[model samples]
Target: MPELLPQIAEPTDASLAASGRRVVEIEARALEHLATRIDGGGSNRTFSAACQLILASRGRVVATGMGKSGHIARKIAATLASTGTPAFYVHPGEAGHGDLGMITDADVVLALSYSGESDEILTLLPVLKRQGNAVIAMTGRPQSTLARESDVHLDVSVPAEACPLDLAPTSSTTATLAMGDALAVALLEARGFTADDFARSHPAGSLGRRLLLHITDVMHAGDDVPRVGLGATLSEALVEMSRKRLGMTAVVDDEDKLIGLFTDGDLRRTLDDAALDVRTAMIADVMTRGPKTIAADQLAVEAARLMETHKISGLVVVDEAGRAVGALNIHDLLRARVV
Candidate 1:
């Protein structure tokens, strides 16, 4: 038997590389084309019309689409709902069966399709129209049936697909995504949605914790506060700090206003000096003055910053009049996830 020759791999085709380059070029051109249309004179009218429909919606914005457009629609709906607008995704096929009942006269429908001729989407138009809900169409083809039937048509027309085969929805989907973002952001600004407002809707998110969680909510108050009088003995102050387990004690005046703080570091220094008298020495003599403090109503993250910046383990929480009302440490912030 003749020995089999070793098979060599064929070199990559230059035509395939050229095709890839062409796809990228088309995608870039599509984005540029969409950008130009947005700034064009007549295009503002289209945006204004879409904005009016969304602003006037008394109920949620129902987003529906088919195929790859459906995925983009879902993302658009999520972005809208999280930002400020009340929005949700509904499959067009589901709507034809029973989900059409979810939409009401008070709601607005946002339909997505690249060709603007998706049969699944078209099937619900008459029912939506009968329900008195306004339809806003997002499509690449303005003259397609969906756009023609829409109350407000948003032209997401891209020049071509980024796919080398020109069949896959690449550039068109990207343009559609960008347009949805533009709409959501525009509505977000129009509604004057703030960080606090966003936090209310996203209480479990990190941004919510940073914005909504105040120092007072997590600080140790009442009996947990480690406090000592200005003239209290070092031993007495240490006892209070140990009992509270806050690693520090606030030295307060008669009015309970914080004047100084004594910590483990202060105790260590006092111990280093053999001449220092723990029982006879006053806390006022050894406590560090001008200790860092924070307002109770301030964000817990801010308190964390102060602690980290000053190289301290704790802080005295003060009232509006600067009276020390509570105390918190690094552990408190860590437990609250504010760190």
Candidate 2:
């Protein structure tokens, strides 16, 4: 018998690519399952109970979990806190050691465990119960001890794992995350939370600037505003501009109503004409008419947009009657982070 040639293994189709596609399909199915479960009659009571417990919370919602579930719990807690519902995350393992002190009768506990039987989380149930705190459990198994002990149980079960080995918490984790988001959004709507409220929670973020930053908040007021009265010489307007250090000045009428504006660019253009006398030429003769202006009550982001659209660096903020009340430049918006 001829000796069998040595068999060499070459790569076929990429298992990594196949695995990615499988993961997407599994997550999609898991999300669909979650949607169906939430809409089903059995989940209505649980959702309603959970909402009532959260709505009745006098203190914070303390979210706790272990391992991968812990990460999701932390994110859920953060979302709740930022969206007008006061909440924080506690580690289940640490609760037994010292973190249990953070829980009080006024607070509600939201515990997450895929198996609904994490020892660390289960161990804190009695303490929480004794403290008279309400417990809401998010788990895959409804019959598990954590679920049975909870005041409200939210089912986050999936059909199966995305992992072919069926040992990893893949689809189940996705389902849990989606459920948490749904809860946060529902609470947000029920509370009539507005964008201004959101801005208060995220004062340092871009959305805060867009929603909370008023033009007056970033505008130059009082003497810092470069201004020149009507009939003032172009030379005098330039002097006011230089003294104010704004590179420009508003030309206003006797009543302080803005009539026009003069800038360094106008100065350069006037200089090109030897016949234009700085001392004798009035600002009105060379000033640009109908210059762009913004209201003091307008949003700084809108001011920024006007500046960009007009290709100018500054704007005069006026009152409802069109009298200049303040001034602002690109630098102001930049400093306010409204740009």
Candidate 3:
């Protein structure tokens, strides 16, 4: 039978909060120390070399580690891939079993081990070195075997762990993750990676939607755009609005170019006036002249900003000639997830 552990009293609320705060403070200090190392400290040159190696690589970045470092490695790989540095994680244990084939001669290997002696990772080093793959090692021990053998070593040694017992991995892992982020961001800047490049790699995410989705992709174009001639009555404009269901209609001239806009808000104001008849009032008389508009080719997020800044719910998409070529509303942006 397995030996049972002794029971202990649960921590008080204040004690629990104190524990959380201490963890954050320790991790924050670790990150500060890491920043110093990259900011003109001894590790600055080696950090630059790591970024240069990744930027110059012709293939993807294969991130590998064991246990807790493996989790951090996976995250680092994802961050690099999404930020325009093509990268993927391979468990070092699995790599030895058959996954080493995933790596290639053109690839860069990023290995993480806080103690700098994870056997699973160290075992693959000989094979990786033989293949001529440049290795970047992140470890707490600069003089450790893995660090000494690597082409470039990033020292992630934290002063202490955040764990109360100081046995669990805490500050060390945080420092390692921060170093991985620093490498990724440095490579990103060196490669001139832009938001557009990021969006391409994360097309299903909200940032991708914001950066990649254009107004024309969401706006109602062609016959779907609600518009009426200047000579048309308010009733005719309402018909167009109801037919298009955009809550607004553009008022154009004989040349079919936008002269004004009439919306549900205008209808409410017009209704408040007993002197005006919906049947007889010309759209030009009741419509808002030169209302806020957006170009059809602009990003859909820009339309959201324009609507927010103007405190309006809808906008007429215009061409260079000031013609109403499209229409969109807050609802459309919501449907497109641009809101």
Cα lDDT tens digits, model 2, 300-327, are 8899999899899889988887788889
TM-score of every model versus the real structure: 0.78, 0.75, 0.88
Task: Using TM-score, give the best candidate's number.
Answer: 3
For candidate 3, the per-residue lDDT at 84 reads 85
Better of 2 and 3 by lDDT: 3
Q: For model 3, how does the per-residue alpha-carbon lDDT over 23-133 read when each residue is reduced to its tens digit?
A: 999999999888877746653598888888998899999999988999999999999988888999999988999999999999999999988898998899999999999
Compared with the true structure, all predictions reach lDDT values of 0.90, 0.88, 0.91
Which candidate model has the greater lDDT, 1 or 3? 3
**What root-mean-square deviation over C-alphas does model 3 reach?**
3.1
Off by over 4 Å in 1: 1-36, 39-43, 205-212, 233-236, 263-291, 305-312
* Candidate 1: tens digits of C-alpha lDDT, residues 1-339: 999999976657886798788878888888788877663695367877788789987999999999999999999999999889999999999999998888888999999998999999999999999989999999988899999999988888876778768888999998899889988999999999987788788888677788799998999999889999998999899899989999999999999999999999989998888888777999999999989999988889899888888788899998877788999999998898887
Shift in Å, residue 218, candidate 1: 1.9
Q: Rank the candidates by TM-score, best first.
A: 3, 1, 2
